[model samples]
Target: MPDDPLPTHAGPFALGTFRAGRAPFPGLVTGARVRDLSDLVPSVRALVEDWDSRLPRLTALAARTDGTWHDLPDLDVLAPIEPGQILQSGANYRKHVVDLVAAEKESLHGATPEDARADAERMMDERIRSGVPYVFLGSPRAMCGPYDDIVLPALGEQHDWELELALVIGKAGRNIAEADAYDHVAAYTVCNDLTTRDRLYRPDLKAIGTDWFTAKNADTFLPTGPFLVPAAFVGDPGDLRITLRHNGIVRQDESTKDMIFDIPRLIAYVSTTTTLRPGDLLLTGSPAGNGAHWGVFLKPGDLIEAEITGLGQQRNTVRSSQA
Candidate 1:
């Protein structure tokens, strides 16, 4: 059986900071390190045109199972790239959002059962009106590498975690077709879309319709790393499992199969609006089990672990910035 044809064509590697004499901090890892394509554009293009012939080598180097992995300690894990832009979508799961609203009502003001139901309905209606794929932008400065401590803003108290799968753009393209969208992808990674819920819901209560920017774009809010698994290794980006654990407690558990706007569709949709360039990043949205609705915010000394099936895991400790 031709070696089972290799479950995936490429990787199962870790993204980390390489230093002179320390362990590479596993920042993020995905089934495929497609993001590298952006860093090596010509090579990726060549391979894409002839994947059957070139995939094997890429897979071999990525696998690197010789147990001789080097330890480089002096390096600091930083954002994978200084991406040209970062785009994120919301409400991609109906059930998740429904559960979110219900949980929110129960935590806020101790609302009655009838009020909770009413609040959930209103929240869903608002989310729908915001659009099927609610989108937001995160500042590049907000990006951080795995193991880097996240500093919560002093003004914010409702800090939350949103575990998600992120896409790294391989080639620069505009008005890309859904059929060709995957071709533009270089790799995938895990993203923790950290936010401040109080600020996010503030405008909602005021009926002013805020854009969710303040809630998301805080310093070091986006923690991404471990490794960038090449695209050839990931046969289907939408079928993998994603899970999040806070201090060893499973909080979010679901499969990418639940995404309303699949990877291909999301790439195409974003391309129609803006040109996606090499090194650009798109966060495919988080599933339902985020900390915002659960009244579970990260406190000092807390650790978070985000993982995707086949992709490696990201572990980080949370610390507060003292005044």
Candidate 2:
């Protein structure tokens, strides 16, 4: 385990699921050490759902350096929390959408690259003014451990990586206001929303912009959580930096400040559509530098490393189903 000290505001603690020759159990991670919390809660999601009442006890336990703690490397880390619903935001980053439009200038009917970019920027500005977020449902079964290998299914060849910051909802609410959105967030975690570019659209149903189920929800596609850092530990959601490396080469590097619709707005907009419940995740979308932009897609045996400022890191290796 990396010896980097936990962030000061992190209260020297985070929550995750870990296995030690048995079924996974919720554990409290303090620095390079971990202590089982399974006695208190069955799973990390259960602890998060009752976070308001459990936080104080967990905090007290974190203060002690003595316990039946285990070295982080000795255990297998699993996806921290299993959310009841996964709400994903699409095209929420300004520069990411602009670059996507700019790169596909041929679709603009004789327009120059500059014209395509300008048009995309205008569209983003209009979107922000509309005061709504584009959110879609994600299948929870698609989630896997942050360190797990991404199995490249035989269905598509153009696999890609999209590192994002995911918000873990603690409080339940309906039609929530932007001002009160933060009150519902319990913690934040790192997530990589992997996609199969070739399956992004349906040939027969071109009227539908994207086929998310085919393109995204593949098994082991969504790599999430080395651990969950409490919201209090992360001061401002919009100020964090998101970075990803493909085969040890820096690819996606951008800040959350680039998001067109901020976190509060995303939560507020999502709540209006459906009730936001505890143990639910709201992914704030990926920034620029996806495979679509770099023109390099994931292949078997490739390695990906992703991280967000303050949050923990993820290191996943890619494998092909044929292997």
RMSD (CA, Å), candidate 1 to true, equals 7.2
User: Each candidate's TM vs. the true structure?
Assistant: 0.74, 0.95
Best by lDDT: 2
Rate residue 259 of model 1 by lDDT.
Answer: 77
| Candidate 2 local lDDT, 1-323, one digit each (tens) | 22333322255789899998878889999877899887667999999888799788888999876656887888888998999999999888999988877667747566787787898788788878975778898999899998889999899889999999999999999999999999999999999999999999898998877899989999999999889998988878899989999998999999999999999999888888899899999999999999978989999889998889878888888999888
Cα-based lDDT for every prediction: 0.68, 0.88
**Count of backbone clashes, every candidate in sequence:** 25, 0
Error of 2 at 260 (Å): 0.7
Per-candidate RMSD vs. true structure? 7.2, 2.2
lDDT of 1 by residue, 200-255 (tens): 75644677665477888888788875445666666688888888899999989988
